[model samples]
Target chain A: MSCLGERLTALVDGELGHEERDRALAHLAGCARCRAEADELRQIKGRLRGLSRLPASDGADDLPTDDFLTRLRSLAEPAAPAAPDDASGTRPAHPGTLGGQSTRPMRQPVRGAGPGRPRDNRPAGRAVASAGSGALRRHQRRYLVVGAATLFLGLGAASYAAGGRQEAPAVTPAFDRFAVEHALTSGDTPMTDPLTDPVNQIQTSPGP
Target chain B: MTRYTGTGRARRRALVAGGLAGALAFAGTVTGDAGPARGVRSDPGAVGLLRAAADAARRVPYEGRRFLTTWNRGRSATAEVAVTHRPGEGVRYRASSGAEGYRPDSAADESAGIVAATLGLLARNYSVSRVADARACGRAAHVVEARRPGGGTAGRFWIDSETGLMLYRELIDATGRRVVATGFTEIDLDVPAAGPRITLRPAPPARGADRPDPDMVDAQAAALAPWGERLDGARLARLRSEGWPIPKDLPGRLTLYDARSDGATVHLSYSDGLAAVSVFVQRGSLDEARLPGWQKTVRRGRTVYRREALRRWAISSGNGYVSTVLTDVPQSTAEAVALDLPRGGVPFWTRLARGARRLGSAANPFG
Candidate 1:
């Protein structure tokens, strides 16, 4: 009832015998979990094959080289455990197992060396895939920040320009003081006239 | 008693002879010197009488009930107030309803000396003559008439013969219709031993700390800052140089006789001998909402606020200045003066710069 985990990779690579492949496909039809893993393996294999066809030294820096693709393909194949005399003492991590999440550990690019240079035991394809996705996310975040800042400054300038003239303070003229002041200057008694007196002002409509 | 009567008649005859001789001398001087244009027989001594009347307003001490009457559209409106004058102190006016107002002597000295000073303009514009001697308010008075050059009496004044105080005055239009009349209905030259009690309303508080003044609000609205002392000619000239609208003359032959200013407002008084108009110019636009129940009129593409009761008031605002013309003249005259003031808003660059400053202030973190 468990999945044919190793056989699924083998089935995707077409390395199994005809009878074995037919048996694996029959099991995959009954087990959705195994079928999904087989499909992911097939896609990864197809991408690696495509990457292998790219010319070496293509001038585009971001594109991984043919040597990196070869290393990635080697990392993708399932191999037996290394012997004790092997220098690395372990096999390179499998590319098929790479979950493609940004949080997953990836190989640091070798400094002062082209992507074709082999340095870490980690799979080159997984590292390039994770790094490329992270770079894309960073670019998207930068664009968002710049757009927001532009909008803020634009709105501020617009508000300032649209704000018309500054008017003097709102003032209600002192009719009584004006009356008294007028009288003082005009040689008349400082008295508020009946016209300016609010109490005497009838609430009348505008006269014709 | 008969001997006293004979002496009085002799004195009367001598006074008449002296008046005639003085008139002749004044007429000869005016004719020989700068005579008025073409048959404008100006009684040179009449100007002195009017000036004396203006001086008597400040020099004499008296109390009386004065009435002002203005006629408009065939109806007359009259307002009466009790007035008390002191020789050196000031004048106090009290309405029948118990509202009181006071003007200090310093204010009158610095400003009102203008009324008498502008009488030369009156003489130049009118053919002033001492028309007659009449009785007014139970006192003998000298009648002085300022006749228009075309032949109608423009103004008449009844000056008390003994005190030289103006007892009554009236202004008449070209149609010989009475425009405005003010006079003492009852006067007592014998001042009371104790001056009348004063209960003047308190002045408004300083700017930004002001509370509503109930008396002022009842009379008009929120009180404005009191104007400083009257501005002299030099100061007025300086203000004009600094772009203040201090015109020397207005329509209706009203010459600027007095000018005063606070920091924000400039008060200019103009008169044509018969009518006194006060124009108050302040830097700002009018808050029309504050003027409730006032009539809004537009003349010659300008908006004027008109209010007519016992006096006429017209207010207009433009070119960063709000001008209010207050007088007892007809409403049409008030409107004309209000409309005649400068119009148009502030320039575009000025407005833009002002707007920028306001924006900067709003954006300041500590503002």
Candidate 2:
């Protein structure tokens, strides 16, 4: 009946056995810092649940950085464990676990007597979380920008091709080329005499 | 005195009996002759005299100053003539006044040429059948009457019996009216060189003031030479080879034929068939505005806008086809014997008219 800080968090989430739950409740009653830590973790979890249910509005002006950080801390926290299976002789994993998709026993946040001690470790952890969120946001923005640019380019190309087809049909090249050839050849031997006799003779005569 | 009177009565009776017998013999001779007895057939000497006179008229070139008196519809018109002929060199001067003068003004030179050609034919074919003693211009002359072999119009000649010179000549029409009559008031043939001083007058100015177009006449003639014959199979084949489409039956009597070059293309035709019209294309434009009895009409083609003159023509241009009734003819029988021509075979008439117009404009030395 060891009542650790981790077991207390598990007991609150209904993951602990009856004996373990009783033991965690007794320890919580004696240690004030652990109780405070448990209370803060519950508040973060409630805020995260509220964020997940928040409706997307037309404007983003009201969303603050503090609210986003609160939601992130809740999602990043470890979840409660489940009970052991006696038939398989193996312990069941916890529910609502973090990154690895594994269901093992839950981990808890550190408890300290002074606020200064927790604050000292909070900056480093916050920096790492902020950096990860920033990377993800930047990747999402790049994907959105690329998609919009591709859509605009596709629309422009389609319009240009349609306009070309709607315009005048292209003429055959052979006809224009032959017309130029005939004009050039006939220029040298323009009919000068109004009389038809000489032109008729030339037309009728066989080539020499 | 009583005896003398009785003798005169007996003498008169004897003279009357003799004269009656002579008259009877002359009547017998006239009745024995055939075809216009005792007229043209009775005199061979007169025929010989006319033939000689006609020959002499054409051979001798002389300058004459005379007067012309014309009677039309019982009205008389007079004109003075001053004509000089220089055998081969052509007529140098001719001047006339009055209505007769105007008739010869535009066609003076052409008429002179026709007169010369007629005289030449007469000179070669003159024959006389009768001769008689007569008086002309108050001078004693030998009158001769001639009959042509084909029974054409007769010719009468009055020659100076003393000098063998012709004094008067008459060319009778088929209707017995004298179509042409020429007489010398004071004829002196083969006279001495110094007899009378003949004064030379200045020639009249040309009728048309415009310059003559010789180049147009030549060019038109060359262009029209191809169309001078009928559009038969051979000619049609030739024209087809030249890329011209000729209709099968172009109905018309060709009245005019002309081909000449005078700095332009000129052609004229008058026909009386389906489209009785005259077509004149000069320098590629229709130029027949002055053809007689023709009315102008518009005609369209692929690339040409033609204005033609339509008219009913009586004369045809071929060698065997009869002309229509639009022209004057002696009889329908004569017209039946006349020739029929194809649509394009009437160039001579046009050529003559064009030449006359061109020559009439200028006093060309060569012409």
Candidate 3:
């Protein structure tokens, strides 16, 4: 590639302005190879632009057909009549298989059995749905039990925390005796209590 | 000068004997000397000053209004009292408010010479030193301070240097905060003519008995009704012989001179010459509900309740033997004595009640 090789891409993309564009044009006019490359790039850009202008549905292969839409609409509505069963009355020798080919047994309500008892003729899908619902109910019951237990535990803790604290014993003081005793042990002379002498003398308990 | 000595059985015997001597002294059956039953010697200086004060309170013809300030919780209460002394007769105190609330105190310390054993105890417990000369009640006063060995002044006294009478006194705590201050606000030295002789009538005896109020005995009996037995000198001697856990001296210089018990609760009277502490111990629980304004603090895993009333520090505490220590000393001394009481295997229930009382006190929003 020559020095003009890089300029060929810039010229085709119109990234060169004014003087750069004129220089690239003059180089392309002088270089036959660069002019051929620029012409090819121009044709590719024109084709890409024309393609971008086309409608979105130009390729119909990415869309759903009329038959597919009819099928989806029928499925979206309420349950319709069950698909027709095999017309042959003979049971296959392999039980669920006819000549090594597996056959799907259509679900048909049991006529001789209970009124609402449906025959288990389909695949194991119905059994899976039944087991799933049962397990869900059990989980719900478990959640309820767990919630009730948590509520009880929380209440008990709060009650214990809010209850009263322990207290100690009370001993009252004899102010009269204290002051008197204080005076006594202190060097202060005994100030006679006019009210207590007779009672003191009277209450002198006899020695046992 | 050592007030208490000896160890073990001998010590117990000596304490019992001393208690008997104290009992005799309390019963007015003996003079000042209770013999060497308790290993305490009388201090002449303190004894003489106290005797002089007592004599002056009675014999000196003087009239003055005394003001006493007492601390309650963090507040102070004052008593404005007018005192009239007439020789050869009783001292009369009249309140300024004239509420007819004049009640003469009879529980004076009746030591040999002094009216109170207080000064003697003070001299025994504290080292007394003369500070300086001051004035009190408009008279020349000699200042004396009663200092504890560890540090801090327990009490200060301003005495009339000429008359030897106590004119002012102040009781202070470890933090040097005044608990009680009593002094004459004004004085009239001139003696008035002897007014008509006023006779004071005695109030009726308590409990309708010919005898009067039984202070701790009743309170103890009410608390310890089941395993209670009243202990006198003889039983105390017997208990000493049997080896009980009674202490001869408490945490401070407080010497236990007399001990009485009603089966469950034991009342031990301790004196350090000046300050007197009475400790009541019982086997039952303390109803902390009865105590208000009492603080709860824990020391060495034991709960203590401290409160001030009636010019004394009252502390209630116990693990098994609920001990309420009431004293004229500082709160620290009272709390120490309460925690150091005899701790035996008290029931879990007692501690529960103690804890409950502490909790109740803590929960109470008001003092």
Candidate 4:
């Protein structure tokens, strides 16, 4: 394998046989620019881990910056073995450069593949950010709706309870009137001797 | 001769003066007036006569044996009553006859006892109105009607004009039915000072009895059971907590003591004022019995109900449950207490049957 190819394979496996590994390490040790490049890759990996733990986006605004990196990685990986130099030349020197004007075009290929991959299938970091943003927007809408409903319910319950209390006076007067009318109109006679009523002989008569 | 003639003239003058004095004395005695009396001989008003007769009857103590014959279609039922009056102890009586042979020793007889007792109580409280007068029994009788103050059944008395005796009495039910009638066929006034004889014996002490059986004492309570159970401690506690005053006393309270066994079950109760105790045994059916002049009263709300009132205050038994509020209490209070009583807790069919039996055997003194 070429020297860069051997070094890339070793990096993927995280291992190298000792003598060749020593020679490759010595080349890296002397090369400040390569060391800087390796450092950038390490930073990229760290950023990917952080993105993986991001809340899934539920709305558009919460999409993560790492989404662009994912598209760049996908595009660069396909051409990486054939033209390693060309792929390396396209990469930004620093992670912050991914958000600048030069890296914008790198987002195009993945966007174009959107039809086959579906928006959420792109990569774990980007999908999660999209899911989280969408969820946050939905939560805001729900809070507004719930707050309005609770206020209306509270007002209704208060009115209903008040109405029940108010009715007591209105109802009691009618009952008083009824009682008075009954007392006045009912022709109640004092109970008399049953024997006085000749018709009631059957009732008054002593039974054998 | 001259001296003798002067003496004769003197004697004649004395005679004339004595005759004038005697005439004045006679006039005074006849007019019931030492001074000149006027209009003392006029006839009294019908109302006045009635008042007088009522007063006289109140003062007299008399008793008699009464036989009442009820004829419906071709059938006739006869009941015999022996009544007695004491000066302060009140009237007491016992009634017996062959017509109600089915209830040999039934509460029916107690009905007469109650009627007689009520009459005696009425005698103490009666005041004949000077406004009402009516003819009854072919005599110019005074008509007096006494009504309960709050509203309840009233009694009317027709007193004889000449004798000041009670010739007839009647009880007017709430439905305006003359449900009970009683009158004298033959009355003896100035009945020999000897009180009238009574043949009634105190009901034999019930079997194994030292005092009246508790069940017998509260038979009305037992009959009211299941319904009475609703007035348990929990409900009473609720009432108390609700600021409803439980009535501890009321005027002219009448209590019914009853015990009935429907072959399988026994019921007993002691009722006073609006409160009644009840005990029930064995399941029973409930059917409404026909009461004379009874009218159905419907009250609506959380509990929809139809009740029949014998009088305004006396509710008829229905659906194995017999209930009533003591008429003496406020209607609202009575209704509250009644509502608190358990609903349909009574075995309606059985209680209804018992009620019918009670009414059937009731000895109506007015009758």
Candidate 5:
């Protein structure tokens, strides 16, 4: 069972069959990442539904109050309206669903925001980034110390390997003994094999 | 009336001719009748020359430039050596020392070890014959080829006419290819004698004269081991009785003549009188480190390392006992001897030695 990216949204919208809904729910319960995304979508859907209600009192719970303010601001502000379906009393379409799979999901508005609008995401984005940077700053020295030691060891090893190449270790065939042995067997005098390298050039006198 | 004397002399001459013809017929008949009694042997002329060549090789004194050529596995190599010799004493060889070729200055113990072999041993399986005559080392030499009884030539010898010494020798394979050939290129006849032009070159130093040959050492080590106590053959038999599976023969006519164990290595020497092969077995797997330039082969469902080194072909394999066969014979013989060697039932000390060697190598920091 691979991830059903759009099917999970379909299940939440009561668009899946009984069997498919049960399987998607079971998968969501087992996978924390899918479960978290599903939970976020549920919250967004509940807030949108709350906006369709008549009104909420001052002592009401956070959802109704948050939904009222968000809807009122979108209407009263000098910005484009998010969706025509929202005013026409039809359910807003869903934009995206859970990820990690290819899908042609239902196109819809997200958080009453219009499609392809240039929104200022920097103000909220900077807040999360500052908190992440503070935590990372605490361990910066440890990462540097470990990286320096690794680099030093690697350089030392490389030099040591390069130094071994000046004199290549080669296996030299012993010839003097072989020549002598062949001579002994052949019935000539047995100095048949030669020595290695410069020693092989050493001249010798004839037998007495 | 005067012509009677002349006619009588002519009749007497005719009688003498008839008597000579009758005697020749009688001799021919007697020789033909006695022919079967002498018994026939194949290639007598070549066989006799080979024996004479062996004698002359040991007794003659000469200085020459000799060339040795070796062929194996479709590859061949030749080396030229300047040689000086004193019969019954020793032989000295000097070669060019350069990267252009491989040659060495060496002194051989010219004893009756392996070279001066007689035809009597080879005659067991080969028929010696004077197949042809050839010129070598600026002298006329008779070509004596040793042909197998069934077919094919095993070896050839070119003996000089004047000195009876072998001017050239070739070891032939079963496929009619020459495996080894060594002969002088140029020769000088008079040396080591009391004469005006008999000046001999001085011998090389004796600093390292007795360098050990690994092949011969292994063979001698096995031959000299004492085994039998009462039965006079029980030392190895005792091991055999202890459930060892050492074999007595290989695929061909090769027979195991000597077997010994020096705690680690089991040495066995096989010979068919003409060819000698040595098998060395030690408890361990094949050493991959020692096999850099060696060729790898798979035979009889086992991996083998084969190479022609130092004029001898060797094939090695190992599982419990690392068996290596070294011989101047063909590579097939070496491989056959190695593959047919007895396996398993390796002694405890051998295993221990193998383990210790590995541990030692592992402990070496430099490696």
Candidate 6:
């Protein structure tokens, strides 16, 4: 990548600042090697999500769900290679710009593609991993989906229950009584307001 | 007492009264009769005419169609009521929709549209003056205008020339816009002088007599019910000790002129003399979901449900008490008064407990 290094990964993760993201995208449009690398990074990121579908099994009580997600996430971080000079040299001098990991090693290319070589034609690693695990991974994914749905439905029911009111009887105000009471002291004739009293059919109009 | 027509002996008597009123206007002898009638033009003649109008409202027998219209936020609510008044028996109002209501003579102070107490307040707050003679409902009327300190007309009243009865009244806001107006569209003198007394007796409904018209039964029941337990200073102080929000004054210079209770609810009446507001307080949380068609608003974290009609209604609830503020004033004034009333706040623990109880009730089928 002549003009971009960790910035390519940051762009794929959508973590770059607006201006820095624009610059990285502009460089990717002209550089074929960086474009291939961006495509490869996207593929690996997709496979990582597929692997994350595995439920944190209670059988391995030591591994919590958050820890499992963190380990799965670690698989996508790639080393930031030394960037060659760009035409304008506007790239940030700090390797850690945009929160990208610069000290890591380059990710191992899956499906036997060599490092630094384009792996566009290789089958996604998700497919290879699923094929190896067979029905076991499928069962774990089904359990994860069912657990998530149950959690969602249970929380919704609990919230509805919390919202239910008690202690006070449902009261619809006696508006007719209220009107007369208001008039008795308001110096108007002690009578109900025809408009406020639902029983009266006085036509109310808008003012200019 | 002899009943006379407009051009008969009554007109001569009215002319003589007018001359006397004009003489009083010039002499200013009745200046402090009600209160300090201080303004640019403090005409006690106008005050006497208004006081006479209040007395005539009860002393004169008349039947007419009166319309009340209130304006708020570029919208208006109007009500046309057919009214019948007797000397001893009070006014009976029949709405256009055929709904009937009764106000017994005892239930009303019969100070016309301006109660005696408020007349004093009006005099204290505005300068009362007899402006001119105007015509209303095809009858000659003496126009009385009350002006604010800044010389703006706060209110205007048109009193019948011959009978001294209030024919029309309108309240004007600080911005010179009419907030409320009520008056007779058409009137007929039943009898010139109040004549002999008449008693109103509810006709007994025979067994299975078609249920006696539910509306009439309701109206009769309302009339028969105890008007209200008038709250005096001692009682009001006791209520205050028990956490009732019985403030002697409210925003907009409205002072509490009357307080009453109907066992379960306390009604506090406030007025700046021209504009009146009533606040009703009851013990219970407001059933917000049941207030269908009401506009809900939250200001400064307080929720208020409001509705505008011939009058404005603003309801709010907190700390196990529900308060409803009703008035013919502007919507903003009603809302401000509703929000200004004291209501206890619910602490975090109380809220949590309430939530837990609700959850328990929901989980229990029998709850």
Q: DockQ of each model against the real complex? A: 0.11, 0.00, 0.04, 0.01, 0.03, 0.08
**lDDT per residue, candidate 2, A34-99, as tens digits?**
787767766766675566447563223223333343345345432322222231111112223221
Model 6 DockQ, alpha carbons vs. true complex: 0.08
Q: What is the Å distance of residue B303 in model 2 from its true position?
A: 29
Kept native contacts, as fractions per model, are 0.26, 0.00, 0.10, 0.00, 0.08, 0.20
List, residue by residue over B252-337, the lDDT tens digit for candidate 3.
56676656543344566777655567776544446567555567888788778776543444454443345567654556678788
Q: For residues A56-115, could you state the per-residue lDDT of candidate 6 as single tens digits?
A: 533233223332332343343223233333311333222221123322112222224322
Which lDDT tens digits does candidate 2 get at residues B1-367? 8888889878888888888887888777755332232232324455345445534443445455433232222333333344333333222222321111111122223223323333333333334444568898667888766555346545676786765557666545445654334455444344333323222222232112231221332211111011212233564455434322222222221222212112221122222110112222211112233223333232231111111111012222221111122211122211221222222322343334444445445446666
How far off is residue B71 in model 5, in Å? 2.1
Candidate 6, which CAPRI tier? incorrect
Sorting all predicted structures by lDDT, with the top scorer first, yields 1, 6, 3, 5, 4, 2
Error of 5 at B263 (Å): 11
Model 6 misplaced stretches (Cα beyond 4 Å): A1-172, A189-208, B1-41, B110-114, B190-226, B344-367
Error of 1 at B214 (Å): 5.5
TM-score for chain A, candidates 1 onward in order: 0.29, 0.29, 0.26, 0.25, 0.26, 0.30
lDDT of 5 by residue, B178-211 (tens): 8867778788877854344223333323223232
lDDT of 3: 0.51
Q: Write the per-residue lDDT of candidate 1 for residues A65-136, one digit (tens) a residue.
A: 333544665564335233122212122222232222112233334333334223343444344444567645
- Tens digits of per-residue lDDT, candidate 5, A1-208, equal 1365645556656655566678778998899878887887677767755653434533234333433433343344335344343222222122122221112221123333443211322232222233255424433654688899898667555444433221212222222322232233333222233322121233122111
* Weakest 10 consecutive residues of candidate 2 chain B by summed lDDT: B302-311
Best by lDDT: 1
Best by TM-score: 1
- Candidate 4: chain B TM-score equals 0.32
**Model 2 C-alpha lDDT versus the unseen true structure:** 0.35
Where in model 2 is the C-alpha error above 4 Å? A1-208, B1-48, B58-64, B67-79, B84-93, B97-127, B148-153, B185-288, B291-367
Please state the CAPRI-style docking class of candidate 1. incorrect
Per-model TM-score versus the true fold: 0.56, 0.27, 0.44, 0.27, 0.45, 0.55
Task: After the best TM-score superposition of candidate 5, give how far the Cα of residue B91 lies from its true spot, in angstroms.
Answer: 1.0
lDDT of 4 at B119: 35
